[model samples]
Target chain A: MTQDAPRNDRPRAVNGHAPDVFKREGQVPMREYPKNAPVDFVIVGAGCGGSVLAAKLAEAGMSVVLFDAGPFFQPRRDFASDEREQEKLYWLDPRISDGDDPIELGANNSGRAVGGSSVHFQMVSLRFRPEWFKARSKLGYGRDWPVDWREMWRYYDEVEEALKISGPIRYPWGPDRGRYPYREHEVNEAGLVLARGAEALGVDWAPTPLCTVSAPSGKSPPCAYRGMCKIGCSINAKQSMLITYVPRAIKAGAEVRDLAMVGRIETGADGRATGVSYYRDGKWRFQKAENVVAAGYSIETPRLLLNSSTAQHPQGLGNADGLVGRNLMVHANDAVWGEFDEEIRWYKGPPSMATCEHWNYADDDPSKNFDGGYSFMSQGPLPGDFAGTLTSSTGMFGDDLLEAMGRYNRMAGLKMVGESMPQVDNRVTLADETDELGLPRAKVTHSFCDNDRRLQGHGRKFMSRMMRAAGGKNLFETQSTAHLMGGCPMGDDPETSVTDDMGRVWNVDNLWICDGSLMPTGGGVNPAMTILANAARIADRIIDARFD
Target chain B: MSQPFRTPYPGYDVLDKWDSPSFDDQTREVLRARRDPPPRRFLDPNQFALLEALCAVVIPQRRPEPVPIAPFIDAALHAGRGTGTRFATMPPERDAWLRGLEAIDAEARAAFDGRGFCELVRPKQARLLRSIDRGDCRAPEAWQEMPPQKFFRALLLKQIVQIYYSAPAAMSEIGYGGPASPRGYVRLKVGQIDPWEAPFGTWEDQA
Candidate 1:
């Protein structure tokens, strides 16, 4: 931020209008909204879920206003294109961490800007398998979704189509035996290196199925593989909500006000949803809307619901059972590094090039030491990544550090996406610390269970053996967590779950949630694609049932 | 442009062989500092000299140039850059740094013929470091009271190496292209190299 901070202050004026503009391709679109405008639907957070709902509702001829605390991210115009300046994208206000296995949080956990985490993710969009829906029945530990994957298959199809997702002709172990919209990405150098390991272990591996466009489709363009996927994508390659849903919503006459932080969900005397009270530019503004949707992802969603406690529902909005912030889950992730004999420049393409889902068939094999299974994905950090974090993690610093760094090109790694058990203790509560806006921060407490240890231990040994078989030496492991889920789960029981089958918050008539927070179980894969699909399905329901 | 690095490993050309970089200004600054680092603002001249010696022995570079490592650490410390959270095992960065420096000098004087750490040759420096690493430091009263072994390995050695390798010169020596942001790599297929990538060896290199 010190060197290449974005100059959002100097917005390009358009047609003698004010600097409030959405520069699409080249054309600058602008409009002025009255302070007290009539709003039919108000969606909180302008990330993947919120942005998708906004686009869908606005397209169906409804007056919608989407709110986000972060500034609009115009990659081509504002991005520094450097990883050092990547921290500007993450939501790093203040979040607590407590776990037996140490996982770094700052830039890795959540993204703060317009498109939210989608704008700064690796974009490995794996759909939830049919068995994943009935996790509670199968695992005998977690909770099951009220509606199964059969009910939401069409929405998944629609999202894959809309996003132009590219993949192999078949995902042998995919959900609903679904085919990808486009061709899979070509196996990059990292994938090739991982292939050697996979072949040695007799494992099946393929190019990772990603929502990121592999070729030009409609308004979306193919990925150039900048290797900064976990950072903000500078080119219009990665199909985040910023380029896809957010812009579409704007085109459909939705007002997206940036830097507008929502304070509380305003409710009437009869416990009916009215509008939202938010802080924007040193003022508390209220926009009256019939329906209010909270799509602020996992951390903020629970925080918002708990913080918006009315006198009627004293615990919080839809917190009658006091189960708003519980069952916090993340992929029990581990990164294993392999120093090879040959050169492998991993910084060029996508870091996560391919995945081996051999161990992820959780339904068939229930006799495992771990409750759930794990998958292996490529982990390709750049030179700066090595010099900063990896080398420190390797425990070889100073002169030994230079020697280890000398093997930078030869070094390749893989992240083990092991499933984590959702413990009641692993929860997010309101911390005593309040932000500048007097809103309480999400106090997080997470720990690995015995199953987590077994999963990671088995995975670490398995990955190391594969690496060695691939003629790799000096194998090392760094413990990490990715794709956080749960907190506000969706189920039939209002006493246990926050939302119902349709992602509607229990006991609240016009309140809805369509984000990772609604996930009952953190599947063995990434949760973003499922979040998108769930949002689409909920948006459809909202469109059908126009409020009375 | 500078001549390519005569790297120790084969199967891949040195990263410096590339004519241009796709990274932004901050990356350029990081690379530039590796060769001609700015003056230290945190550590005094004595501490700076000691750190330079520590860095040299820690990551012994045989380059034609004096590989810059310690200056970045000095700059980072001067800027009061914490690593998000402090280690429960270690003291504050600046205080720990000073203690570690004095302890290193004490060990050097005790081992060598009354010579400070920086005064010793590279081999002698390595020997002194190994002693500190093994928690064998019997230091003077001037040295801060701390766990010698943990301090050396965790903070002193790890932090410095991280700073050193974060530069372009260090990465180029090992064939790294750093951060590719605006101009992303397109040739992602296996066994195919992008036009801008380092010339890698065939399947023969895999063996």
Candidate 2:
């Protein structure tokens, strides 16, 4: 029930990590500048996709400048193993949530750190099912991927290899002939408990393929099973872009300017993205680059694009179609936890290590009243994303709730995330509110559809059964949202979508999007691996593009 | 090395200082407030007393030592903290808390033979709470306009539950591990228990 002072509620300052090898201060340093040179690429947002784009482009010898709105969190010093302390990594941007069911705008929406939400992701790295690519074709709803799974399968493989995804040696459930680069980490006690319960109920459960390392590699070590993955993993076990792609990109000579909020994408009368104006160090600054990659997550990506309106492209960059902030999609996530007689001690390993895809709606489960289906993720049976849930659901409280905390270790929890329909009405727009930075805060408008509620209702019935089989009692359930997608959807039709399959914004040739912003649909799974895969694919296209 | 270790890591560490953080200031302060609460900054003396008595009835923890729910609630209200969402009929947290505290006492006085809420016995206090929860106490201005159930759910019940859990002492009674840094959990497989985790009677039976 504690609504903390929003990040911008004060003139915020966090100390630089003492043991940090990177020369950074107050999210400062690592700048490739006399502040004069026009880099070859200026990528906004240093998150899942931008980190990869910067690294790959820099590796290809493109001079890249990356900008992030929030401070850089140094892993060793900044990342606390405790979830309570590590919540500083969340973005506190001015945001408003409104809908039939308002999405958690505080924590789970998107991250604002230098590494973006990647720094705090739970390391759930499931690829989008190949059937999901054909969702529009096979299922009669949502837009389909212009390119099929076969076209992007190699990119998924490459991204996994680069991220060092550890999974079962033989993944029978892969879309393509996919093999994980590393062996699966051992499933924790909670997973085993859930697996037994799921088995009793005829459900398919497996060790969730995690991007977290299973074995030590360089500074990034194997997960200590600290169960601190969501809090930005300590000991560098979780491969957030901070330790993975951002550092690699920086090592490959991409300059990262943290706490540099990109205000607008500067375009010329020729309608080509020329550069960007940003706010840094209490003043306004401009950085020009040959190419611009707006990967500031879904909301910020479109916000910047919509704010970049000029006389030539007056409706925002490629907004002649009025699709800049249209079609926001977050998973219609729901959960059911049962109080078990045995102390599961759910908070031991990764917070979520087991998933059940029995109800994947991509092929269209006729049993479901809705078109899309849901995948189940096992939680601490404790609440939230402890903190992500903090920002997500606002905490549940009561006499029963107080008693529940006493038995927090005894609850077996499961989360169901199903495909959310991309409704244009559920969108992000410039709110009437603005931060001290004088920038319009993202006015997020999201409402769960009938399809979402129907899918969640279906998942709840099975989740209850699995819990009962696991020797649980007093089943409690609450529905929530996870894995936000589809703000700036990519497609062949520029009128309906924001970017091409290559993530190029229509009307602006050099301006590209390489983040969750480009996703057309949320594919009934965690979107991180798909985002990374699509970014790799987009970066490949960028590398091969013959620019005039 | 990957195996789990117990908390309070037998560490040979330094003394309490301004710079050295054993726990963040906010956490440290909250823990401190749980133990030796600061004087009421938001609620007046009467409001504070009523809240403490109400908390005792709501949570009922008076065995060895009491879990002080009033102080934590006071701090949050003073800081203007809330659940971030509320019933439209209810006012902002600061005003809601002020009026809610006043209304509860008013209800107790009206229902319990002209005695203040804190003056009443535990059973009497419980009766008044049940009455308010059921929207039977309609005299108090705050309860008059809005449904008492709404007030109890959004403010009163939510606050008490939050304050109770915020206390490490309450958490420890339930065999909860204190939030300790540099202490990350390791043993996570089903039928597995790290030494740090609470041992339940059914552990072997479940296995």
Candidate 3:
């Protein structure tokens, strides 16, 4: 655990263990700055959503201030150390949230640095199933969303173009549709084996759509196929916010103030947002803006609104319906590993490069009572990570055991990423504890429903069958977890939601909540692309409003 | 036409320097204090000889140069201090493992006499390893502390691969050149939309 020193002239230690720094806590003198200078927009949390919003708004000539609690890190300067040290400082150490049992909560590995979770993610760029938007209407699980798939699809295309996402367009299993031209990667021996296995099981597999820039992309180089996608990519192949959206926002004249933590949102008596108060450089600073955007993730966004108490709305900002932090949903996932007779060299490419979506859509058969479809994640971890994850469940050691480690380099594994239904009980709230910075910590209370567990078990069985068909030896099941979402859901009815269809707060006219918090349901695919697309759509709506 | 890949980022040169270790006076002292003679389980040349004999029977050298298992065991035991806890438990599981190997050697000596475990030829070594792998060894204490089969699985799957995957020769075998290799490639085409079908059906179907 490396500690960051104060930005002032203080000699810092390498491992960040300085007692004097902690002892001098809360002692920076606050300098009074004019709070009268106003900006058109203030976007909190400089993640994928906030950064994209900043770039689009700044390009439209609007004054935008982007705030992120994490410190600004220049990869060349800050991460110039060896991969091990860089991972210790920028990747491994700060990622795991300080709490009891952080790993089980999915908080242990999520990034809290300047780039947000995008820095540490595997860069698997996938879109939601078109039917996901209508899950509520189809299954009678929740309220229907105000907009349809076509509205979101238009924004998805805009985001894909903006982010320069490149991948194969055709489905690997079904008949060809007249879509965009597809790009393909030369399947490695391990992927070929998995493909053969899937074929043997009468299933289809294909190259995955990764956010990485392949050969000959301008400014971004091709993936060296190091299979270290979870670690911060040294090469600019992975499309993290630092490389993609944040840089473009900076170039468009948006001021991204890193290390700036927005503590509270101040609302006016007329039910409008006045400004936000933040802590930076160990001093409280107030920034006044006509419009406020909360993109602080599923947990923090709602917590921010709920924490902000105002005279106009005593309960919280835009909490008339009392639905600020409710209806949280996370994807149900599980994995299966396969040992083969021949060497597969599974750790040769990205953590994931292909997915099989044969079971993604839910069947209409009432007797089945199936939860949702599942995607086959055929990517294996690097040797070190693989060994750690594989041996975590089994107790193996000694000389003979040493020989098995050699065989692991050639092992391949598959994971089932399935969707869980939106449950109101599984949610995020403010815990009794507070962080070192004197802010209430976000506490997540989540558990899989019976349906979710059933889906997971079924997915595991399917993956096992696929591996067997692929001629895998010594195959077995692995554990899985979920990511929190849909706490402050967006809907047409102000009675049941916090944000409107355009992501604007129902009562607070100028304030908006972006990020996964506004998602009414957890889609059956990775949500990064959808988050960016929605952010782009909301930014367009804000620009069209022409706020003065 | 030779097309050089443009430097990915302008400030990436600074990362090269960052990657290089800049040892100061204090770091040198810490390094000196940390340095010690390898423990008996790792340093004894007989341990490497035994490890080589066992790995040959398990994985078997497919081609010209089989994986050198001794270095992996030595490094994993050394590196395991911080990265892993399997070897650092009570009774020192690694030491117990070494004791298990010694027991196998004692059995071999009892059968063959006056000769080291490795000197008894390939068939003898294979027979000894297979017995240990199958938990046919005589030491009940060592087996109770660390099961032979479990230990064999860990040794073969974790530590051995850690060493092999890191070696340049081993990497060349799989045609992998790490993330920095210049041979990497990604092919991109425009107008491609995702083909994943909708997970849900139409409103009429639901009705």
Candidate 4:
């Protein structure tokens, strides 16, 4: 989609009457900063990470500027219930994806708007398994995160409380973090199928911890079980960064600029990040800041860094060790669909309401063929997405496609977020081609390892048994990947990682990479909550160092 | 159009909830736009005709009014709308569509005595499309930058399927509740149906 399409065509307050749904009350208007005057912190990408950073920094009384390439969509006015119209929420900028097993990079891994992919993310909020943070030491695989799980637990608790995550009172896996802020929601039929299968297979299944509110919060309503979680939620019930952190950032006096594409990080002769040069309002403008944070996620973050190569630093800002765009990871997100005799109209609640994280937590089990594991959930895909899955995932089309679609109500699905091993070769490099913005496009090269394939194969067999145990037949599997991570990884050693554990670039003193890009290894779960927790930790560290 | 397609929920019309709380005002606008699709903008006259024929084979519908798949796709391409990702091997969306249609037409002409894809019969078109889907591109020259099989899966069939399912008629055919906004589903357990939702059955009388 083009960057110029205005999202707010319909006014929220129509005829002096505010709609009961998506009530926008007590939202503080975002502050604006002068382009010439330097702000304390200029964060690129007002998404999950950027929004959190901006909120934390601004709340700490820093003059912050948050920028995003896409619109600041007010969901009540901008979003549509239709899938075709809602496709605008995705990062539709035509990034090149290539490898031995080429990844499909649109709706699954990217988003453009201020809220970013969280705007349309299925709200499967999960914590990293405590051992995954030290996978190298504990599990004998993958890179070890510099941050400890105990320290990360505080950040996760903060994020969970802030977002008001609705989850079980006592989570089965990991350390007990006490009760969730809100109670768990009712699991749908698709979730029941998963629960049934989990019961038969003797695996733990629980109503997933989700960012979508279960009880009514101030101004924002609770979830209405609309089943269109992958599209932008019209109601503010989804608790996206758009509604949660972005608003908090604004309220704390952060200037959130939408539709502003940051082109380069302006560095000075002193070897420090000075400000940022960006494209906004049909002209290239400079926003001077004391420090800059690249929270543009994996692809764009690395692309921006590589594009901002200076005379002093020829390779890139944080590419001293040449690890800026290296070690890109995407979870092996494949689905197994089956048909049953009974009507299993899966589209009733949030797509992933119930989940089984047994595989992810049971890493030491001798039955496991792979080093890492997966967490699969029952899926409630809308009709349009389901149809697309049928054609792309399976080669079902023509009369056969129509016949299969006729049995849409009878179908149930289980999709996995399996852990994939990170290789340096799987990376984001600058392509020869340029985008409409005249910036070098990011060419994401990714391929699954043997461990990844084994994990997926194991997941397929596990899901098949579950589906059959739930009396589902004619099962078929579809291969795909989701939740991108690790381009500018964070570690204790600068030579081994792009950024420090606190997300500071080793070479660039004032610059930071504060997003999922800092994630050294993506755990076997949805990465949103973990990303938020990482951002919170980074923000806290930045705040702590600010007074130093 | 005769009612030949067998659907479990026979009489469920999603459009019936158009005036209900199920659909919000923005959803109504989106549906209206789809119902009255924009004229073909990106595809040339030949390509447009070919796309229409190809879509017919892809999703052969027997409705009172078939969904205008080709026009919607052409409009999206004209507007440079994408899901924001593309295969490194393939050309851009517009180039892929043009090259794919051209290559498929070339295949049809080669297979059926120099007649283009639009001139071919339904069975012939289906056979040609199946070949393209299977990566057996006879017209290698026609597919310059884009792979035939990739164009079929990633672009052509994907767009067609997505567009078809976006229509209200397709929603009715599949027994989908149109748009749950102000009023959403409550009874989400097994064998429980919301009063507004379509009942489960394959009875012919309902159709």
Candidate 5:
């Protein structure tokens, strides 16, 4: 743990070490490894899944090396209050977006730096609804996850404790879980507006379950409500992977190599994984390992597998069934904004402060037009993003845009995380073009189905009604997407999935896949908590099967 | 056009907190650099002048000194700071901007007796822009492979709006609490305003 506190009410550093990094009290220094030497495990992508798995494996007396393509940022120095400057935190490398309804990538979904999307993600932590795991078996649509929801629930509790999540004492949704690790954050006007709408609509609402600490925890301070959660949190209060698992992994003798882009997973004639070839410091080098794990999330994971085609696995390491990049899914994050006469000042706290999962219980309400469901939350967007929203949504410019923006403080919005159908056509393939690193870029193709369109339409109408009921005016909707998933789904049948329940690649024994890429269905909730929980479960299975 | 685009929070300047605890040193540095226009690297003098005129139409400013939106966008393009992804049919972001600007000029010259976009009046310029926004522009050759509406929506309007709103003056006009760091907001209820936060209405007398 870091030893320093906020001194003189001013941040100490501009860009190097964290402000709290006076020393790691009673902790060992971070481990380092030689390139030619073989560690027990070589993990790709040091973000939510990779960082957590590294910490777990290292704690179990395993030598591990985690690699990320982006720089390991020190938040105090790197995170700027300005939105444009903070764009550095996102994956700004070129990717080709195509298909009928092409999804806009970056900022909303992908991240580049060490903590990955977690560094800039709005810290809304939520567990997957129990029925979501058995979507096919219980709800009769989408694929059922290989893992049981009951077991996943226990892992969710563990992750909440580790991250010190702040939430309501008794969550009003899903199965009865115990209290959160910390007290709930104070609800701002945006949240109050959401609560008013929920009460008018006669639905349950609660303080958002967030990874950000409400009160001081360990070396970190409480969140000051700077309202820059989606940007990099400079205060170390957000409890992102940068402040949590990454440090633990380092303390437990794991070597994290950032600014190192892994190009391919090296394989041998015996059909077992040997090591990884990565580029760093203007040179291409190889790091030998006993086992290789690809935790590069949705797009990069499948891209890495497809790019690493070998003689034995000509189609890709885990693409023998051609399911590696199939079924790419994204949450339908459609939003409805309205103007109120009262002072709404929506940018006062963490975005998505209050949320209602009433619509997510699809079984309870059989009147829905779609198989899956959605949940709506109050939003707190920064001015830059709000201006962009108004411009895109209404095509307002000059005087009209200025008039709309004059009421920025009086405007509030509700955004939904609606579930979209996972179709095989929505997949990531290698584009003809290459990136600055001379690697083939990912070409993502996606389009919404009729069911998804209906769900979105329903959500917009419902949210508009709620806003109007709560004394709002001039309501409008904007279509968007967030939290990319699928591409390497974990399922029981190897023919239909890329990995098994434990994220182990079906055909490749020594290779594994972790992160959001392994999710079979994109649940109607933020996937950060679920992703971290899944990573924890995978780490345990790996530990148990060490003898093999 | 409507009420002359009045600011609700008049005289509430966000830069008053420039030296305050609310902004960290790096944030202060970034804002300071943004205040001054960087040396032009990407666009030539003619293209740069056209960009300035186009940005003014996208976001009209009444201040004595408007925020430098064109220079920042040019710098971003010079550094190859694309939004990471683009439409498969469109060229790179830089090339698209080049084509779009050229098309705007072509439309202006054809419509207004061989006059360039910079030489046109405000109403005429806005009309040409609206034509492009509606994809009704007849100058197809100037647009080349890029669609006029697509270029306008994806690049021109988005970048201009983002750049304008990111400035401290625009944030202040919108009554945003610039950057909350050492001292964050309290009293978060409806109609509640912290001491340092900009009030909802004009605070000109107080200032």
Candidate 6:
């Protein structure tokens, strides 16, 4: 079991020496490893799953070498108390575009930091709907997983405990609810409005299960409810991979090499994974290991595999099934804005203090034409973002329009997030273009089908009605492309999926994948919980295999 | 004269309240030459004058205040570069497209002679803005192809909304604390939440 370090503990220099004289302040230290140093395991991508797996495997007496392409983010040191400083840290890569287009196609703003995308996302944790695992059987659209939800429940419980997740046990508005494990906070206005609106429409609305630290569960502090949850939390109240798993992994004797880009995975003639080849500080390095795990996100993992071509598997490593880069999924999101007569003061609390899980599960009701559900975002925009979004919507110009904006600070908004079924066409491939690093950046090509459009339309209508019921005027709906699932899918059939029950690639032994890419179907709720659960499950399997 | 004035400061013309120098040719030239105009950039003097007239009509300077319209316009045009080639060249193109706009403005001024856009009798400025929004150019397609309606939308949104929101007064109007305050808050939240929002449950839960 991991114990919390003293509150004032300073980060120990690697290899038990003083801080490197050559290293810049706040820069991740570089280490020279002997060529082909043998390790028990090599975990690629130091995000959530890779960090967890590294820690777990290391704790089990294995020498783990973890690599991430981004720098190791020293939160307190690298971040500032000011919000603008924070935006600069998060959005400094000028190469990352910000328009409503794909990054490969020149859209800005996706996380490319040490902790990967997690370093820049809104912390919304949710478990996969049980049906998500068996979506192929129920939805008749995708392949079913080799393992059922029950097999992953133990890992889910373990992850929740490890992460110190605290929430009411009985899910609000859930069927057959049990006693809550912890006290739940009162719903915020946005959540309350959504609940009331859903009730008025005779739709079920319940408290959203979030991973936020509302009250002290372990060493983490309780949430102050500042409503700025989307930004990096200065108080460590919001859990991120950098704070939670990566630290624990480092403490447990795992060596993390940030800014180490893995170029290819090396396998033996027998088709078992041996190690990985990577680039760091202008040199090629190979680390041999008994096992190799790819925990890079959906886009990177498949790209890595496809890029790693070998004589034994020329199409790609573990590409015998030709399912390496197929079946991508992303949620369809619609936002609705409602101008209120009274000030809402939305910037004072978490970006999402409350969400309605009322429509998380598919309904067979005759009145509802779609099978997907929606989650309601309670917190509206922060002042600047709100101003930007609001002004963009309306054709407001000049100082006069600016003066008009000051009058309506308290307007509220809602976002409706719906799950999209997996489709082979929605994919992330290597773009014709390459990045400064010479790696082919991920080219994402995605569009919604008629079913997705129908779901969004229905969801928008329902959300608009709810806003009106909540005493809001000038209700306007905004559309957004989702940034959720795809790349790697899990199943028993090697012909259709990349990984097996434990996220182990079907064709390659000791090569596991644990990230959003493994999700077979995108659920309406956030995927953080499921990702952690799946990572934990994979770790357990690795432990049971006695790879250490 | 007996009608109740809608404004809080009746007869208080803030337009006459400023002491700053009016936008002059040198200032305009300096602002115009800031960046090498994108290929085929087209904002000429007459078109620029027309754009200024249109902006003044839409958001007239208020009284008893230092409302710097030129600075605002300069900033808006500078910031609007590369938003698209069409928008970047709008100031120059305004002269080429001046005839139709002049006709429209004449009609608008006729409808409400001395009253500003806000003070105008209903539907006058609205009618003009609607025409501009709709790309209602009377010129032949040969002379100057009215830029696409989409280009106008981008220009309007960029200049009117994006540039306006970036200004300090405009920020105050919307209660925006600039990107420094609330954007930072959202960034912090995103940092905390983004990683945790990954498929993994939470940072601590990952193992």
lDDT of 4 by residue, A299-411 (tens): 99999999999887789888877888999999988888898777778888899889999998886678799987699999988887888888986656787787788878888
- Stretches > 4 Å off in candidate 6: A1-35, A81-84, A87-109, A173-182, A217-219, A267-274, A282-284, A391-408, B1-172, B176-207
Over 4 Å off in model 3, which ranges? A1-36, A76-109, A172-182, A310-315, A362-369, A395-404, B1-207
Measured over all alpha carbons after superposition, the RMSD of each candidate to the real structure, in angstroms, is: 5.5, 6.4, 13.4, 3.0, 4.4, 11.8
Ten consecutive residues with minimal summed lDDT in candidate 3 chain A? A13-22
lDDT of 6 by residue, A205-291 (tens): 555555556677554566655455555554555667766777666667677776677888988889787889887766777898878
Instruction: Write candidate 5's Cα lDDT for B89-199 as tens digits.
Output: 788888998888889999898888899999998878888888878878767889887978778877888889988888888999888999776567887888688888997
**Which pairs of residues clash in candidate 4, taking residues 3 or more apart in a chain or in different chains?**
A92-B84, A93-B84
Stronger candidate by lDDT (1 vs 6): 1
Pairs of residues clashing in candidate 1: A398-B58, A398-B59, A399-B58, A399-B59
DockQ for every prediction shown: 0.27, 0.19, 0.05, 0.63, 0.55, 0.09
Error of 5 at B163 (Å): 1.4
Residue-wise lDDT of candidate 5 within A474-511, one digit each (tens)? 88889888889999999999999999999999978989
Residue pairs clashing in model 5 are A14-A77, A15-A77
Predicted candidate 2 versus true structure: per-residue lDDT over A86-195, tens digit per residue:
55677644365666666764456568677788887888888777767867886777888877888778888898898888887655354545568888888876777678
Q: Against the hidden reference, what TM-scores do the models get? A: 0.82, 0.82, 0.69, 0.96, 0.95, 0.72
Candidate 1 wrong stretches, greater than 4 Å: A1-6, A9-27, A30-32, A175-178, A271-273, A282-284, A362-367, B1-166, B179-182, B186-192, B199-207
In Å, residue A164's CA in model 5 sits off its true spot by: 0.7
lDDT string, candidate 1, A1-548, tens digits: 11122344222322323222233235435343454664778889888789889999999988888888776766765455455445567765545454454344546667766778888888887777677788778657567887767866777788888888888887767554467888898877777777888888787888888877888876556787777777667677788888788878877878777767888998889897788889876688888888888888877888898898888979888888878878888887787788876666677667787888878774455445676778888877766556655544544444455556666767788888888987777877787767668898676777888888888888888888877877778888877678778899988888888988878888888888878888888878888888888888888888887754
lDDT of each: 0.72, 0.70, 0.60, 0.85, 0.86, 0.56
Q: Candidate 3, residue A117: CA error in Å?
A: 1.6
- Deviation of model 2 at A36, angstroms: 4.1
